[model samples]
Target chain A: MTLRAASTAAADRARIRAGEHTGPTSGLAPGLAQANLVILPADESLDFPRFCVRNPKPCPLLEVTDTGSAHPDCVAADADLRTDLPRYRVFRDGRLVDEPTDIAQFWRSDLVAFLLGCSFTFEWALAAAGLPIAHQAQGVNVPMYVTNRRCISAGRFDGPLVVSMRPFAPDVISHVVDISARFPAMHGAPVHIGDPEEIGIDDLAAPDFGDAVVVGADEVPVFWACGVTPQAVAIQARPSLAIFHAPGHMFITDRHHDDFDTGESHDHP
Target chain B: MTLRAASTAAADRARIRAGEHTGPTSGLAPGLAQANLVILPADESLDFPRFCVRNPKPCPLLEVTDTGSAHPDCVAADADLRTDLPRYRVFRDGRLVDEPTDIAQFWRSDLVAFLLGCSFTFEWALAAAGLPIAHQAQGVNVPMYVTNRRCISAGRFDGPLVVSMRPFAPDVISHVVDISARFPAMHGAPVHIGDPEEIGIDDLAAPDFGDAVVVGADEVPVFWACGVTPQAVAIQARPSLAIFHAPGHMFITDRHHDDFDTGESHDHP
Candidate 1:
């Protein structure tokens, strides 16, 4: 299947829903919002909401669907929840059972879908300022870690705060923080910078989550809240049923990614 | 009971936890964070989390406690969730049943506690910037409303978005937006400014939630997402068990109200 550029998020979602685009959605719709998807049984819904609320740094919420409502009406009008994402993960009793492009076969009315803000939003801010994201340049996954600090738990959702690490020169760290901070809809700002041990990550090369990236000697390791949190915490809680986007396969939204920039309005004013 | 102004939120929480203070906790600990509390059974936890993630404007999550765990490690640092708040409301099957000072007697092992961001944090920001908050001057409850617009539902947690209204002169609305935008931890910025009907609110005099205040002709009716959202949505969902802060009563946290400001760091550099 051929991937198209400048496709509106809605158009891209339709193509993905139709199984025409099985590739990663990076740069597909430059301005559209892309989301991290987490689906869980209704029983754990309340605690999850509390968890996201307490940990907004990593899981800045975009849209939460009605119980069993696969459509995220607020962000993507009339979009199908089960199949719009390029790929998905099925976790049963804390273990991965399947990696499929569509979750329609396992759809449940009792399942709740949470569309969380992803770092893709902030990448727009960085690019707007002409800063290059290293991972994107290398065509590899961004590094992530399970921090020593525990996240505020809610009911069946409790675990350590997870952070995504990005290496940048000292001059760029402040710029990165400023750029990312403007996109609070995405994980906003760095949780830790310069020191890895302070947050209990001893080896930058070995991450608990995503693949690690090389940090230049002059570059400082800057960390932001990671979307992997809900998955990590939820799995630890061992819900009977859970579904999420497969790593690197996100749900693309109708919103232009630029709309995710909270600071754009400031600039206009 | 005597009112005390303690220097630390922990100290204030200790006093409240010991049954020494039973009144509103509006201005007790100047720097400590105060939250809107919502409690529900484990069964509804999943849906509620989705609800909060979807309707972030009305439900800025602060902390979510584990099942049967009254203590949220992030917000209060050992404070009991069931009793730290000045008061609570018990809703059974959607109907409010009781308003009590402490919920320890009613605590269940399956219950989950959620602490949501309150407007108090943003109000502190406005006051710090010399913006006038009329309700603070009148010593009354902030005006809130149930709008015609529906919130994104998660399971049973579906209802109209409830917003707290504040009137600001046209000149100050932009500053209010800018200042409040910095505190995304506290509902961030105004969801709607100027026209209420655009969001489905018809009359300003009639509020679906809190008391109505005067809005002068020279002022624009600015609305921020209210913490009342969880309660209103939960009631609509009609969970078998639900508890929340009784309107104005709130949970005092160790973090101060001003600590929510995400702008100072950005402004300093």
Candidate 2:
């Protein structure tokens, strides 16, 4: 089956909702926007929104569902949050408990779902523009790190900036920055282009999250703010209860990745 | 004294906070970022945020204070919403009733303040680039009109798009689009450059808000999404209570108007 037939975003959502498709969501919805999901209680919603505002590179918010309402009209028009995603990681008091294929058991009337822009949105843009992604080519998860720079604190949510790394040749780094910057809703521009140590990563080989891919002799490492930020911060805060998409198992929006493009006109706003 | 010296932004806020300056804030903060202010009860906050997300050009949100918080940390760290601005227009059930300089009397613990980017932020850039502003040149407010275009509605905040008009010579319309496009946090680019009737405005001589300016023979009238949208929509909803910066009065932010540039790398994203 072609990628399209093998991975239907709507179908996958249905299967996940039915407890059938319990695996990573990457590569499932080829052109659709797959998001990093963060579910938090209503009482602590203020801090999470502030955290995203202060660290937009990682937490470019796409749509914020109303408290106790599972639907985000803007991004995923009709999807149900409690059981639409393939998997969810539950956190209690900032500690991870169990990874569940569905979260209906954990659903609460006071939860607010946030759909954040993910790197995958820009990756598709880059690939279509003929930019090579080394990690994807190597079939490995993108490398991530905990940076030395602290995120601007918002109430109880505060932690080090988390970044995902992708290696590209010198000239290509600029191309990546130029392309990714256009998707401000999806982390916009690269936070740092070169010198990983500058941001406090001691070794690229030992990533804090995901698998590290090779950085070619002529290639430089490019970093974009990661969506894991709000999650990491939320988990750190140990809210009474929180839920997030398992890493790499994102929530798919009805919007095609390209549909998210406001084009040059969007750059104006 | 010239408007430049007399309109020192820092001093204007200082005097306003002290109850000495209680008039329009226009031209008072010269080169600083002045915002359109909207205060709504907490229950209505989500719809307004969605309104901004959908109609970004008219409502490029710069800062949204947490529900009930008087401080907008990103815009003005120490400014108090209750007393900083020169004037406030209070609406009860969507009808304007009181125009007060201080909102301390109406302050509520569940109020949410939204600061939207205003066109004034880009006016300084246009003049610096040698583009003439007909309204400013004539010592009048920018002419605005209600357009036929229906803004992408978010919940109960549905309304027609409102735009401000500026006449520019044919040769300079493209340049204006290019310069203003940089400040997305400010209404970035012209919504319509040449035709007035196309967007449903009947005459250039009459305006929905502010004063009309002369359109030279070689000039074309340009329309941009206006900040008046939120206030107009709010009044229509006639919420139990709403407060906004009176026309020509705005909340001055610490960010220089130029700091919110989004044009740097549009080609890639």
Interface RMSD for all numbered candidates:
4.0, 5.8
CAPRI verdict on model 1? acceptable
Candidate 2 structure quality by residue, lDDT tens digits, A92-133:
888888898888888889898888888888999999999998
On residues B1-269, what C-alpha lDDT tens digit does candidate 2 reach at each position? 23353346557788899989787777776668889999999886667776776677887776777778898876676788888998999999878899998999999998988888888878888998899999999999999999999987766888999999988887777788877776666777778887788999998899999998989998889888999987898778778899999898888877666456544552321
Worst 10 residues of 2 chain A by lDDT: A260-269
DockQ of structure 1: 0.32
Please give the range of 10 consecutive residues that has the lowest summed lDDT in model 2 chain B: B260-269
lDDT of each: 0.79, 0.81
**Can you tell me which runs of candidate 1 are displaced by over 4 Å?**
A1-7, A40-54, A64-69, A89-98, A104-112, A145-162, A200-217, A232-242, A264-269, B1-7, B44-46, B93-96, B196-217, B236-241, B266-269
